[model samples]
Target: MTSVSIAERLGQEKFLAQTYNRDFLHVPGAFADPGGLVSFNVLSDLIARHRLEPPRLRLTVDGETLPQHRYAVPVITRRNTRWDRVHPDELHQRLAKGASLVIDQIDHLHEPVGDLAASLEGWLRAGVQVNAYASWTSTEGFGVHWDDHDVIVVQIEGAKRWRIFGPTRSLPLHRDVVEPEPPPAEPVAELVLTAGDVLYLPRGWWHAVTADQGVHSLHLTCGISPPHTGARLVGWLADELLASDIFRTDLPIHAGPEAQAAFLSALRKEVIGALDDSGLLERYAAARDAECVGRLRPSLPYVQGVPADPELMVRLTTGRARLDIVMAEGETVTRLTGAGQQVDAAPAAGPILHRLLNVGWHRLGDLADTAGVSVADTAALVAELVGAQIATVRSEGR
Candidate 1:
């Protein structure tokens, strides 16, 4: 089966260089089959099976979040533990009253959405979290609110109308000292998105959504983490500057004005020098990608070690993993860095790791053939990756 690449769906380099983090993009029928990734049936199944509580699963109307008691009740389980499960009758009533349903971090619970988010992370070089929204009425769920992080919204089931008021503040932060002023009275643009439509809204763009176009709406909003800021760069630079004695020395708190001025000048020069490097942003982005704490999954049954089974399937868990080749003592060494862990292996294993990083899944035999090694040796290498929580193995295809 052919796989749908999210990067291609979003227009790849064109979207990244032009529309990403700069302006809103509306792509009609971009998903073609959004239901393949998620659907109303999937949301129903999740609600019926999982013990989801407020915030993780919420009902909101007119910008106010409804309490859990409005739709769910606590029931004593057979284990004598109290669990809050969705009361279908109450949930229906609540929806009838114009409350929108929300499932936070749906990517973690759904495989297709998880893969979509991982693909986005690989393309955008930033972490992503996908939230599912289902609305039945024209009532707005969030009113005119702006997210701190940029969002790529995929309309999965129905139609939703969005009134977008462009940002009044420049790159607002969650913990900013000043709050963004109220949005303008009139929206800059209004868009109606139906099934298979995709929308990208940058952070700080105030928008209100409603499912009033004679149809209910179900959509997945993929929240991309905000880009690195100047503040963050300065913090990282401070740590990087510790190598200099001037930065390590104590502050001239009780010294004369001349001493304080000299100290300030020296500090400014150090910071400016670091900022002058043309590769500063590139280096910072690499560090962030290398340290991404990606989703973790356990390779069950093979608790101790992976066996040399030809049918076993393996894949990397982290999408933002980095592979580097280094020549040490006239011999090539390959380094795999990601998910807060680093692994070094012989150059022969580079092909195998690169394949796992890019491909969704590979059979042990295929990986062994790619690396030109025995199945047993390949299994051992995969076991090391599994131990580091960077990769997982399963008997069934994912």
Candidate 2:
């Protein structure tokens, strides 16, 4: 998080607003130290330490997945067709040679990466997930293909040549009825991305990448701003109108066409009425933000409740945690956004949440001072969060 505004980092909002569905964008040299943001050594260490399985951790060439045994042998092959042992050295050598490596859901494996994704989601006002990709040679792993969602690409090391052909479909999705038409034979643009370059490619944009610059390349693709679909709208509506008898009734599958048509007509009215509200989108956005289950991590020591310790440092464990104010019984309630958790403190939790939401880091004493509460009380509150896995406390190495 540099202090750069979303609009500034994204260039002109109007430009994106206009061309968002029509074309692709390439912002070269966007970051000063892209490679430094995440370390390849750390990622390699994690993959080996965790023994992560794929398609989560797979090497691909031309849209085909290389056999796991090519690198990793099964120390224990299971009845479920899964293996426990994977060859890290062989996998590393393949990546260093030019094969594409995809580590899906990178956030789950790394804390810094997860935090960065959450921060972007907050800034962009949408959900974001980061996937890490690495390549060593001049082979196209996925070939010329389009993603179902928009991606923010950060080139971490070496150099990668990107041939951008732009988008053929308008706002495509993973579960859409129609796919985009084939991309043009010729690329619309060609660009070389080196360390620290950031690229934005809209969904349905056909592009190809290769490490032709003769160096190994590692990058993180932060997928952002997934669009809400009709299916989602209906799902949300069903949850909201669960109390309605007609909605809760079983479908008239056994009825005649006329009877079914009548049933559908009524359902349509209710669905349309729900969507017609001006606040529908905003409400959906909020609900989605609040319900997001971030990377769950447990905090040691504070197993029961937070101690009244003044020197403890606390930070949110989840990147997308929400803090809001609501009036209940003529008093304001401090509502924690994600996971629908809330606390009814003596107007003191408000300051704690304010500091939690806006600041990246907080010490127990500072939060207590802001809330006009004792350090011990603040520690107790933090302990509760730790128990819920929503916040973590760092111990000063004594």
Candidate 3:
């Protein structure tokens, strides 16, 4: 949306030490024309036209969901359904009378927002999910709450006031041990975000938002992906260690104390052994990155292999898919990256993969000499990735 990079908005690694998770940040006029952030009319139209389902489409008020039938077609609310229990019609009436309307994960349905999210992933080096929240009047949505993850707020249109209380808890998780204490009565800082204004609030900070600016409000909250934690690593380690014979052995549920102690010692030794590996966590993160599947959209019409057209654009769907790299016999080696899997090519493949990875798209002829392959052959290789949905092919003029 704006030429301003995410690094510029949130600052980079050097700034991370000083600014991250410490205080509230507000950047005004981040976009040249702030009103162009998103289309409020289009969003409202989508809500009326589409049959938004639960988990995807939800209306929350005071931290509870409203029934679906009232918002959708005029029909009976299914008794056991999640929406029926929440009673959305009543919630809408309450919102019209000043209630907060929150729709989680709105990027799934919206296209403009999705494009922004993809761009952000390229900049942030991690996955990003955008949620939409709309409100009328001055009523607060969730009434003084803190999110478990950091958020980048883009005010699409209208205006909203934010009261930030900061966080009492540190790096809290969704399944946290204890809930954070109520925010202080007086806010540590107050901010009013106009269209195109951007705000960054780290996770665990207490904040409240309302469309109290005398006009309807619409905004998107882009949630940042959290760094890998020890909990995740241990969980992955447990799975990896299942190959060991001791780990495969059954628990000594009814065994004698001596037998149980021996069993416990064996398990601990195996767990500790895995932890001792200096590269274990790095390997785990690489594995996780390779497996991550970002939003995969279909490429219609040319369902078959991609044509060897130089103008056809391509990009990877997943942000974390690593390029392949491998060492070989004697002095020869291979380094492959991008387009899902990497292949050990002759020395020529290095420049080709390097070029493609460095830039979003390149002409087939451009990579032909570098990869030691013809333009058609390169197209076939790209087609393989397109078929895998890891890469996409878009015609230039269409």
Candidate 4:
């Protein structure tokens, strides 16, 4: 990866104001040396190291996922557990014949790729999962399709052509009420993404891709979690209404129309009153953000507590982790919420939390020095977080 952070290189402010959730964006030469971010070697190592299933790794040809049996053979472990082990020779034959190789959740498999994903999550304040795609032939890996979530693409090597037809339906969902109509005869925009290029496409945009540049292609698709919507708000509201007796009451099954109308009338009133609250969306977003669990990882070898070593590195497990101010005992308190835990710390710890909320690792000593805290306090705080799996720590050498 370049010394430059991915968020800055993405021009976060400009993209949000002009392009986010509205249109597509293409930036050529985004990274002068994208190979450092991820290469073919990394993918090879990951496959060899992990017992990846079809969901984690698979091959596709023209939108259909090829059977694992085609590229792997079932192996019975000593415990008698069976799983298809990918055969390098068969896998190569399939890819050479025009099938596209894909590794889902590549971010979880590789640390650098995980860092790349965390940068986007920190900027967007949304979950991001990156999948790697590699193709050797001019085949349409997924045919023509649209995604339920927005995606940012990084062309790591070679090139791939994309035919963008825009959206036929507005913000389609994975379990949508209606599917999009057939795309038009021609694409609205057609372009090739070479190494170091970046592209962003909003959800529901129709597109087709092919690696027909007479060279193999390797790319990463970073899909952002879908934005909170009115539908989701209503779902949340349903749970919130449980405190009220009317919502908790049984539905008037087999009741007369007049009685049913009375129940609905009360329900409608409750719904309207909740919707009238102007901060409903804001409140819902905060709740969801607090509940988000990002990249849960263990801080091994420190099972008991984080040691008071100044050189130990630390980072939040989730990029979406957030810090906010709340009054406690008539004094200002810093409340952190992420990885499914809420921690209220002294206001003095705000700086330390802020540093950890960023996208990379940090030394415990550096966090203490920068936050104006003692190494002992820093170790204590990190120990608490590490115990909760809200953050992880490692030695600098590791």
lDDT of 3 by residue, 1-398 (tens): 53135457666664467776666688887765644545766666666666556756666666666666545544345574332234446656756866556666666566556666666655555567888887777777677899887788988778999999988887777877898887789989999998878898888899988885657788889897764567878888889998999988999999999999999999999888898999997788676665656667666667977888766766666655555556677556544433344445556455665655532445667766666777777777667667776666677668
* Cα lDDT, all candidates: 0.87, 0.75, 0.70, 0.88
lDDT of 4 by residue, 167-211 (tens): 999988888899899889899999899999999999999999999
Which residue pairs collide, candidate 3?
A: 66-88, 67-87, 67-88, 95-99, 323-337, 324-336
Model 2 score (lDDT) = 0.75
The TM-scores of all predictions, comma-separated, are 0.95, 0.87, 0.80, 0.94
Q: Write the per-residue lDDT of candidate 2 for residues 1-398, one digit (tens) a residue.
A: 33133236567566467645456656666777664457789777877788777778888988889888778887645555655566768877777765788888887787667766767766556677888888878889899999887787878888889999877777788888898899999999998988777777878788998886667788888887566666776788789988777799899999999999999999888878877899988787788777665666666666766677777778775556777677879988776665445444556688887787652558888899998988888887787777666777875563
Q: Would you list the rank order by lDDT, best first?
A: 4, 1, 2, 3
Deviation of model 1 at 333, angstroms: 1.1
Error of 2 at 110 (Å): 2.2
Query: Taking the tens digit of each residue's C-alpha lDDT, what string does model 1 give over 1-398?
Result: 01235567677889879988899988887767778888889999999989888889999998899989888888998989997889999999999779999999998898888888887888788898999999988989888999999998988888999999999998898989899999999999999999988898999999999995647789999999856788888888888899999999999999999999999999999888999999998888778888886778899999989999989999888778889997767878898888888888898898899898773778999999998999999999999999888899999754
Q: Is 2 or 3 the stronger prediction by lDDT?
A: 2
